[model samples]
Target: MEQVPGGPERQSSTSGLPSCYRHPGVETGISCTRCERPICPQCMVSASVGFHCPECVRGGSGSGHSASASRPRTVAGGSVAADPRLITKILIGINLAVFIAVQVVGNRLLDDLALVGRWPPAPFPATQGVAEGEWYRLLTSVFLHQQFWHIGFNMLSLWWIGAPLEAALGRARYIALYLLSGLAGSALTYLVASPTQASLGASGAVFGLLGATAVLLRRLNYDMRPVIALLVINLIFTFTFSGIAWQAHIGGLVAGIAIAIAMIHAPRERRVLVQYGACALVLVATVGMVVARTAMLT
Candidate 1:
C-alpha cells in the first residue's frame, strides 16, 4: 500500500481504514483498472491505455487479464458445452472400435452383440436361428456397417456435418436429432425398401445432420441455396450410385428438416417439454408408418 505519484490517497473499498494505506489522504476515485481494487489517488497511475493500480502496473498483470477471463464457459444448464470435435472423435472411435471387434470376433457374435436384422432385412441378413425384430435393428444396425468404405464415408460425413450442426444446436438437441433421425431414416427405409434386403449405417443420421444444417443456416440468416444444391447433388448420387440406400437418406433428411423446423421456428425461449414432446410425436408417427408398411409387406 505505498503511494505511486498522482493525487490524494483514498481508503480501500473493502477496508474502511483511513487515508489510502497506499496513498494517504489523496482521494483517488479511480479503482484499480486491472483488478478493480481500490487505488489511492497517489498509488493510482495513468498508463497509455488506462489507469492502473501500482501493483498491477508494476506487476504487468494488465496485458494478461483479458486473456484469462475471456475463455468461454464450458457448462450450461447442467451440461457441458458440446465440442464438435469431441463428437466427431467419439463417433469415429465407436465406429472404428466396432469395426475392429467385428473383424476379430467374426459373425458368430452377431446375436450376442444384438446385430440381428429387424422386421425389414438390413444390409446384412440375420444368421440362421437369430430372431428378427424391427425394434432391435433400430438401435443395432447403427453400429453395423457393410463395408469399410460404408462406415468410412458415413463417419467422414458425420464429422463434417455433425460437428457444426451439433455445435449450433447444443449437445442434447443434437444428440436427440441424431438418434431420432436415424430411427426415422430407418423407418422410411423399411417402408420403402424390400423386406428381403437389409440396410445399415449412420448415413441416415448424417443425412439428418444435413437436414438440420439446412434448417439452421436458414435460421441464422445464412444463404441456404448452397445447402439446397448440395442436397440435390447428394440425392442424385444416391440414385445413381449402386448399393446406396436412398430411402434411409431421404427419411433422415425429412425427419431432420421437420425437427429443425420445430427447433428453429418455436419460441425464442424454447420450452424443453414442448420441443421434446414434438420430437416424440414425430418419432411415434414415423414408427407407426413403418409398422404399417411392414405389415402390408407381410
Candidate 2:
C-alpha cells in the first residue's frame, strides 16, 4: 500500500506513549522528521535533516503539502512501503518457527512436508508423496529444514539479500518472486531427483533472492564483481557439497533472474501486468512440470 503522510493526527494509546506507526504495539519516543509519527528503531530511517519513517524517507516533503500527490515510487515503480524489510523479517520468523516445529515434532513433520517424488517403497499404500497427490510439498518443502547449519546459512543469506530486494520491488512483487522461485526449484527437483529422494530447505528461495539481487544490482548499474563472485562461490558449493540439492539452487536461480528482469524492465505502461504476468507464467510452468512428473511417477 502507498503510505501517505501528514494525515489528521492519530491518537496515542491509553498508556500515553505513541506506538511506532508501522508496528503499532511498540511504543517509541522517536518521531519521523517529516511525518512526525512515532517510529521505532525498525521504522526509523536516518535522513539529511533527522530521522524519518520509511514512508517519509521514500517520499513526502516535510511541508506536508502535496505529499500524496507527490508520493515516490521504487525503481520498479512499486509504492514505497512503511517498512521496507517487513516481508523479509516475517519470512525469517516463519522459517525459524518451522525449523523449531520440525525439531519438536521430529522426522514425522519432515516426512509430511519435504518434497518427495514418489516416497515409500512399493508395497506401501501410495498415499504420501507428490506423485500420489500430496502437491503441497512443492511449496512446503521450501520452508522445511532439518540441520542447524542449513537453516542458519539460508536465513542469513535471505536477510542479507532479501531485504533490499523487497524494498526495491515492493512486497507484492518480491514475495511472488520468492515463492515462485522456490516452487520452480521444487518442481525441478521433483522432475529430476530420485522419486524417493527427499529434499527440503530454504536454500532454493535464498538462491532465488541471490539471483534477484544480482539482477537488481546490474539494473542499478552497481558493481557486478561482488555478486558475481558470490554466485560463483555458491555455485561451487552447490556442486561440490555432498548433500546439497543443486537442482533446486540452479532452478531457483534461473527463475529468479527471469522474474527480476520482468519486474524491473517491463514497460512502464504495462508494468504491473507484465511483472505479475511473468510470475503467473512461471507458476504455470512449475505446475506443468509437476503434472508431467506426476504422470511419470504414477
RMSD of each: 18.0, 11.1
lDDT for every model?
A: 0.61, 0.79
In the range 98-134, model 1's lDDT, one tens digit per residue, is 7778778865444343222232244554442113444
Q: All candidates' TM-scores?
A: 0.65, 0.78
TM-score: which candidate is best? 2
* Model 1 score (lDDT): 0.61
lDDT assessment of candidate 2? 0.79
